[model samples]
Target: MADTIDEKTGTGRTEQIRDTSSSDRDFRLEEIDLNSNRDAKIKNPLAGIPHDALMRNVEDFAREREMTDLTDLLKKGAQIAQRPSEFETIEGLTDREREVLRDEVLHRWRQPKALYFTVILCSIGAAVQGWDQTGSNGANLSFPQEFGIPDTEFLDAAKTIPNPNFTHNLWLVGLINGAPYLASALLGCWISDPLNNFFGRRGVIFFSGIFCLLSVIGSGLSQNWWELFITRILLGIGMGSKASTIPIYAAENVPASIRGGLVMCWQLWTAFGIFLGFSANLAVQDVGRITWRLQLGSAFIPAIPLVIGIYYCPESPRWYMKKGMYRKAYNSYIRLRNDPVLAARDLYYVHAQLIEESHIIGKSSYLVRFVELFTIPRVRRATLASFTVMLAQQMCGINIIAFYSSSVFVQAGSSPRTALLASWGFGLVNFVFAFPAVWTIDTFGRRALLLFTFPNMAWTLLACGLCFYIPEDSKAHLGMIALFIFLFAAFYSPGEGPVPFTYSAEVFPLSHREVGMSWAVATCLFWAFVLSLTWPRMVAAMTPTGAFGFYAGLNVTALVMIFFWVPETKQRTLEELDYIFAVPTAKHMRYQANVAFPYFVQKYIVRNKNAKLEPLYQMDKNLAEGQARSASISEKP
Candidate 1:
């Protein structure tokens, strides 16, 4: 039998025993050095030892095997096994780090290059959202007049409606716009997983862009209201897919440090697109209703770039790893990182960690996965957080401003043309102020902004609502209301407008993120439908003042929820967030870590000190130990 050798030193030793008689076999063993280091070699004897003798020897050895040591060995073995997988993860990275040496590789990605591409691509999708949303706004304004209905006939038809008021109309319009959003939200949830599964994220995006273009054209060419509504529904489906998939694509592809910044670009582009649409409307206001068709039709320009530009974009490395296509994933990683070896190493690390933390949840059926979101506490919290944020977003009455600004201004005593121009100003303010949100979402964090701005928004709306209650012939009161309206838009664009979208994308884990965001967005759509359907009636009943006040109250409720529940997620890495929220105790504790919390409470909150700080520190330590172990193992051969 071959004798086992000690691995640390390539040395051999022999064990000898005396024979009692000639009949007794002579027991002699000589150690031979093996070319590799394996624990199994150290574990077994040359010949089978009796159970009693093995037990005796173990008792005499004095040192028992430790669970921690066993754990470390298992972890080390896993690290070694995954060394080849590191290459697969690099495809998810941006261009700046592609040139770095393996030894010098760091987790912080090169920002401008990777983030710039992410911003640019995601911006394309967001522009589509803005154009589609605002296109409808501009189209509706002209549709009433261009259809050749008398003003009295239009108002009479509107009055005959079940909810015959400004609030009811506002709510109804919200519902109409939200109908497509609802479909998009729900479809976005299911389509994201499979679309990503078969064609990859880039492919899904390319297809969605095509759909958006077609929908826009369909909307522009519609000769009737019903045709326009159907096209809008189609456009909603496209928007839903884009809304769900694009954020996941951007979030997964960027480095942890700048992920927030890149995702915020989606909002920035949305605002810019709305502004552009409004600008187009203002420029062509006197050029006849055909200009509205042109404005609505022009969304095709950006859709073309989105489809073509996405063709060159790489698939998410994480998705590639999940599918077990390691080699292809590796090649993609290399292309993305511009370094094969380093790509392999990072891919291996991510794969090993994924395997270690693997759960059965992700492999389940779609309905099962969807159900699990509500059943599991952490997932439930995440889902609710997303939903609540989106609900708050819609309830803030911003959509009423977007869809009914002309109506609201006319009620405020402005002429029809002046009201339309003021509506354009609202879009312009939305565009200009959105930049501050994009700039501060990462810096100020989600909860901070929410807490700070929501109350002000509520007050602004309340003041505007009160202004409506003022008697007519008060131009001074009207001036005050107009100033407050401008302030309302300014506050909303920088705060509520961007945060809902950003928060929905950030709070959920990657495994269920798409579905979670889909549901949240869907919730927005549902409420939008309710608000739109009822807004006209509410406005008719209470006029503009009472309608604005009702929404202001809802904003206050949203503020209370945000102050107590929302978390600060500005700089957390995906992995760190995963581990931080995995534990039941940690999950609830983290919800209170927002920067706006009291200092003493922030420090002393249960598990806040340990739970919040420990995972990130441990992640770093584990990653370091894993790298060291890999180096030791790789050095042997």
Candidate 2:
């Protein structure tokens, strides 16, 4: 379609075809999308222009924008963006610019102070979200009783007594505990589209933080379960909006090389906040009637820093560009990048890609763009991929543990004290294990980690449930149950924990990102709402063993969904991903099942050292590699 680049020269070339049929157009589009990465050879719309002509165009572009002072810098920047790795030959290159450019690749993690501050702000928002969740976990033990709505009472290890109004109490308690997620799914997440449209990313986060503060205060002061429910309903709005916005905000600002790790800070710090929430739960579990109040209210602490610090952070430069504030976007980029030259390169490069993106997903009414998330082919693929990851997150049953691990431990013959301790142990394991993913995610890539860990999670959860069959009289019973759950958390924290949000945030084109993310987060939180709402009743009826075993089975199903639908996005920039998502789901599925599986079986299962596994979409060091792959696949029996 637009243009193609030579891998060695980074110069554009065009090929003529007599066919103008829609099928041919579609074929060319696939070529651009599927050839996304060939050892850094990608379609560049700006390629093949002569240096003099490109510089002249840059001069005119700057003059029109009242940026003539930056004309020299802009010329060099444009040249570099066209041929990123071959900047050494670009004319008018100063030693300082050259050194900075080199440093960008060598020290990608070495970023501007403002960029890190932005990440911290986003992370704080995530912590607020995580903390809000744990408050209810600990508060659940005591709040219902205080409100004259105790759901149950245990007389012995295996025998539990339901309250006379147990059915009503169970629904109310679940409703109260699950209020935030419910509000998030139904209202808060969807509103993010409009909020982001009007208030910008920072504004949505700021307002959400304010909501979180109000809800936490109201929950602590509520005198009844219904009052607590209403208050948490308010908290859900904040949680939904904040959850939708934070990952997108973080992903937009970070470099692609380490994007997985940086964007995943949302989950890592959320786990830390979960740790803090559980810590608060432990600290106040013995405070008599006030324990639950303190647990519920302490969640407000993380929100305070989030609201205050977000103002100091720069808005996403891409957002600035979308809003047509070019000068302001460039200024934001200056503070974000380590050097002005790098800033210039990114600004122009992103702008060029955005132009191409606009052709694919044009500016339309909000409703049209929202509809495009499913109706447009490329955007629809992103929606499906994002939906798969988000749905898989819920199906993996992490939220079951997150929302009701304390209850689960209590049901397994643990005393109130032992349950809180075990919940704390799970929290600690969740937080501690998440640290390794920060490095490993970027290294191993998101898809590999998910595939490797899901089976492990499924088995561990099954083992945990089976351990419930071990007689309570056996000293090994409780200890064995805790061990398996901790192991499950270990697998979950790295794989599914960090992936869904980070993956969803970066998949959609900027035009539809707000709405696309709204859909993705809604899917996640809505399912979370269902899980939280139903689990107490489900566990009560089915018993912990059956309920846990049910979800363990779900883990395997999620793994399969992930294998076919989710694609690897490691080290690819936000715009380059346009092509990645453009790939049809059916095609991607075929590649995974028919090609990737057989190759994996040959290499890993059969231990055939000489086995050659042709990559699915990737082109190796040369052009013939991709051709050979296509020919090999076609010849496959």
List the candidates' TM-scores in order: 0.72, 0.90
Compose the digit string of candidate 1's lDDT tens values, residues 1-637: 1121233463543222111122111221322111111111221111223323322322322122122322322232223223222422423333433334332324234433543665698898888777776665655556645543212222233234433343434444445545566567556445766676567778888878988999888877878656766777777777777877787777766644456667777877888777777666666667776866775677776788898888766677766655544455555655555344445444544542343223323344567668967886556666766777888988788887765666666667666577667878888888888888765876687767887788888898889888865665777666777777878888887778888777777667655666776777777766765665566556766657678989999999998777655555676545444443443434334434543344435566643663333222222333344446435544654
**After superposition, candidate 1 runs with Cα above 4 Å error:** 1-115, 145-176, 186-189, 330-346, 360-362, 469-479, 583-637
Q: How high is the CA lDDT of each candidate model?
A: 0.60, 0.81
Lowest-scoring 10 consecutive residues by lDDT in candidate 1? Answer: 37-46
Candidate 2 steric clashes: 2
- Model 1 lDDT at residue 322: 58
- Regions of candidate 2 where Cα sits further than 4 Å from its true position: 1-42, 153-158, 161-164, 618-637
lDDT of 2 by residue, 1-637 (tens): 2222343474555332122123322323223543223222335545555566666667765764457888777878888876765677777889999887766556658888998899988888888888998998888888888988776652121476675666677777788878888999999998998898767899999999999988998999998777888999999999899899989999988888678989999999999999899999999888799999999999988888888889898888887667655577788889888888877777777876776676555566778877888788888888999999999999999988888888888777788889889999999999999988888888798999999999999999899989989998888899999999999999999999999999999998888888999999999999999998888777777777888899999999999999999988877779878767766777788889998888889999999898886655542222233234334543556
